[model samples]
Target: MHDTKVTTDVMNPDCIVIGYNEIDFAEHARRKRAEKGKSGGYHDLLTNSVLLGGERRTYMDLLNIVRERTTGCPSRLSAFELPSLGVAYLTSFLRRRGFSAAPVNSFNSATEQLREMLAGSPRAVAITTTYYVYDEPIQQIVRFVREQNPDVPIIVGGPRIQNLCSDQSPESRDGRLRPLGADIYINSTQGEDTLAAVLAALRDKGGDLSRTPNLIYRDPAAPDGPMLHTLTTVENNDLDENAVDWSYFDPSYYAPTAYMRTSRSCSFGCAFCNYPALAGPLNLSDLSTIEKELRYLCDHGVRNLIFVDDTFNVPLPRFKKICRMMIENKFDLKWISFFRCSNADDEAFDLMAEAGCTAVFLGIESGDQRILKNMTKFAKTDRYEYGIRELTRRGIATLASIIVGFPGETEESVKNTVAFLNRTQPTFYNVMLYYHDVLAPIENQREKYGIVGSGYAWRHSTMSWQEATDWKDYLVRNVNGPALMPGYGLSLWTLPYLLANGMTMEETVEFIKGASRLVIKGLDTDYLDPEPEIEEILRGLAAVRDGAGQGASS
Candidate 1:
């Protein structure tokens, strides 16, 4: 088992940073979570169990759920743990500045795990609310921290904090902050420096945080309320200066892979996108620094990389140069990226393959030209086929991501999407029901689409949200593809992850086929009954996971 304990005193870490993951669990937390599991069906366990948020359960919880649904099923599944890149960066940046910090990666927020971390008694505790975490989990973490050490300041920051900063009134901010119960919130794109300053302030400034940039905190003494606001904006980090400190992560615990961002923000402003607005303007990393980071990863025994840049191949010249740099370095690494199908030439594909690109994720969004235009995707429908064909022809895997409903979506448009998929034939495909985020550019044009409601319940002119979901289910069941990966988190780095854990492309495809079958079966039922078919599929995955070599044929 990997060392689950945070080695605080070894480095005398100045702060403890916690990253919350809902399903993935560290080895130590697995047994504890499973022991808490109750008898239930697979779907019930999945939705009701919370590894961190929503329902609190882990893989062991899943095993218990499955066992309850099947006779003589195994007691456990192998651990699936992956560190958070954001948390890793924060830890590394702190350590690099002479402040020791320990990272508790893939934490499931179990009470025992919290006790282990609090045992170190670090100066401050920082929680990153990046992705997949909700209010219940945040409140839980904050409540426990206060219970253990009321005086120790709890700091919270991430995408949520960045978004909340848009409203600056003390009363308005206090109303929002009162529930989570954090002492501070950082609203900066790069909070490494701001966080460091906050830690230093806690030690040196008698708990005064007035000077920290991009910060919002509560001060009961203030006449305005308990929350005091600091408005100084912190500039984005110089990529070269803030390279990920890989020392904080275990190369083996993750999928022999690392997630890197060569740039920040996205260049294109697709109508459905909120990333560009949230991330500000595009900022590219220095090429020399990029080369150095690649070399470091190679030296550290990392076998693969997932470039997290929003448009990794944008500004095609820079893209080609990065490819060429990887080639020139003679690095022994395979990579994947979020790709734009347009403005790409044959040379780029060739260069990517030669540089060891094993797969790519294309956010194709829509198949019909009309839908594409309405979404402001800025990609030609024809070029998507060309890109998929070229990439697949070169032995590279492609994941085609689609959004079912947009403002202008119609039944005919849905058929066109299916036709487009059948014609192009990517290595994998996934369909998602469109979600209406208030911050997305599409919100500005809601009346144009005759939209009402918000989030998943949203509807526009040609289709209602429920229709989109039904169509999504239809596409998943009806579409013919090599594999249908889960549309959401699967794109969140699944290809490299599968490969990183030693599954061959063929093996991975088989596993996905089994998962797809389970999805189909789950959709057809209320998911309360014990299903032999689903049970059989689970056994096949378990066999593959245990290195039995072959997956059960679908």
Candidate 2:
């Protein structure tokens, strides 16, 4: 650790903010293949198969398209999109306070960038570290800032940190979650206030941090202990579209549409979800204000937008009003958002599609209703199927996110999920492994329910008011695997049943193939949908089979 005594005046004059995007291991692996004159890696093969009906595209064509879209900034453009959303939000927030904040994608060279940025100005650096790939680089940047300019404060925050600080108990701590690192840990959902206070502290403006809420920092003298400040609650106001400084963003890096946070809390309290605890209850934005924001995005040439709400479909009337406004105003932009499957219906689905909704993501959680109820999801199986079918029939793409492992999960339940997927025929399906946290806040309740902790919880699990921690590593490496004896037998039994229902044998093969690709490529399978084109190819195969059968008969 570097010293923290150097003043910002003596150091660099500007405040530099660095956000990390992990090293593109997939790109590196692809280069290795090319050097050896080999064909595509897993990601390339998977994407090509899914998007292009398994037809191969030249590497040069792929590279050119990426270059055109990203403006030659970085080859790992897709990975940067999500991080860019956070950076964009923070960038606007920081600028509102009259501070200069630059969003840098501190790949592997974060330390060098920090050093250079600090050389010219007495600067403070803020970085968001998420997942394991970011750990070393962020630590390096923080250490360098402390060593080179000790007074320059380095602060870190993100979902990873919020999860790590959650409760960890023996019963709850399974090896599934990853921990986060940071000097000041702010676990509040409203990060703008905490971020503002940090900037004020750096400037010696001496703001009342007690009102800032969600600010957690270490007293420099005491390394092990952290001090938590009382959080401030801000009322939702109708924000003017012109209030945000959009000019600071690089057009190439920013998504075409802006992400707006319409609410701060969630209504449904799912056990696996940390949203309710982090964001608190749902506080909605004024429908008129939301309409204005949507108009602004469309005016700025954004053809697509995404709502970052924890549950965009909650408050059914409010959602309908927003939809009516979009339709009435003739807003032509397509959008997607997350929704709880249990809360949606045919009427809601029709209204959303009428308002240019292209897609909606559903957190289906599990195929087993018992698992759903156990997780406090409160999702009804019949309603979920109805909602899915209604949305699909209306030409609205439905993406189902399913979690595989839960405390009461058996192998039979997993097969039930596969069977459910076959029946739904959702446009996209995402399978997530169950994560276990060592010290979860809900540990005591585990005994109350007579349920033993899986020794793992998500980052949102806490003990005694601690924040959530991520357990991705443990979940992937330990909790998830092929089914065991009883489960395997159930899987065997369910395979034919699924095919008999609606899922073709080819689709089942594709699902397994896609899962294997994820393990090999470390790429998300959610975005891959090679099914439509693959279906056409399969039809041709069936035709050929029928022709051969006719010939044999003759």
Candidate 3:
């Protein structure tokens, strides 16, 4: 941790902000194959493991290692096209406060480039750690930052920070925060105010953090011990004031797909989710504000938009008005959003497609009514069927997201989920293992369900965590596997990037399906170099992306 210094220059920058992008395994695998060739440890391990009776644990262990080492791996798709909107939001907020901020592109760039940027020696370096909870990449990033600027303050904040400090014990929270190797950690739900206060204190008061609430930092006086400064979260009500400054982004480093959020939190509180708690409350952007942002995005050449709203279709009136606004403006843009299957009117679906909604992500957690009730997911299974069918008839793609294990998961429920997927025929579907969190509402009923352990290692009365994982893999192998897209089972947000990069919906589905087949084959054989096949598919897609680019330029 760095000490408080009086060397901040307002003209240079208040700080340099960066965000971690998720690793695209297909891209990672392709890079590894190029660097190591087809005859490396990765291939040898798989071949040897298969010859010696394939051990699933060994294969999984290797994959985990690959995920850890694949940090800083650039992607032509996710990295450049889908940059972190969280970083953009914070940077825009800081700039609005008259604090010059340099937003670093950590997605498609390397750490050494960050080292070059640190030559400016800004007041502090802020890193956004959200989405996946994997800390290995974060640890690597923190180490790189220290190497670049030994004495500069490092501030970490995001939804993931809330998860890291969720434990009531100070020691546990300190243990987690300290390992990230940052001078300051923001543990607030909404961090705009907390972060702004931190910057102001660091700059004007020589890093006096007493005024900054919701922070974990080492006291300047007591250098040996870390201190927690806690307070009630002050939510940001006026989101309209902070429009993203597109000037901070490099057009060459980004694609035409832009991510926008029309709301702050979800209206419903599902038992297994902690987002509602983290986001404070549900606050919708005014329709005027939404239109202004939409116009600004169009001016910046955004041909496609992805609304990162928790529930975009809720408070149905607002949803209808937004759709009508896009239609009235005649903006040449396609969009997508998360939709609740219930309480939706038939006219809404027609308006959605007419307003250029190419896709909708349905969080249909389960097709079993028993599991839905257990999850407090108010919507019925039948409503989900109707919603998907309605979207399908209107030519809108439906990505049905499924969770394998909740408190009451059973084989019968899993069967029901599979049957529902088969019947609805969603354009895409993904099954994920339940991520158990002690802070989630479901924790209140842990004893009733006989829940034990935490995170991906948890178990309940009905099944163990391993059973859930195995069931997840089974669903991937069977449940409409041939029809649904593959390469994006983990990251559904990347689908819009494909559409923006000049791939037709049919072409995108066919391309990902080809990759999905190899994935399924690997599961069946337990041994095979599908990465080489995956690399070929990516190469083809890259050509299409490039060809589209050349044509546009012409």
Task: Please give the RMSD to the true structure for each candidate, in Å.
Answer: 6.3, 12.3, 7.6
Of candidate 1, the 10-residue stretch with the lowest lDDT total is: 39-48
Q: Over the full model, what C-alpha lDDT does candidate 1 score relative to the true structure?
A: 0.70
lDDT of each: 0.70, 0.52, 0.70
Tens digit per residue, CA lDDT, model 1, 393-433: 99999888888888888888888888888889887777676
Clashing pairs in 3: none
lDDT at 177, model 3: 76
**TM-score, model 1 to reference:** 0.84
lDDT of 2: 0.52
Q: Candidate 3: where is the Cα deviation over 4 Å?
A: 1-11, 21-75, 107-112, 228-233, 245-255, 481-490, 524-526, 531-554
List, residue by residue over 289-364, the lDDT tens digit for candidate 2: 7877677666665655667777888888888888889999888867778876677666787789999886677788
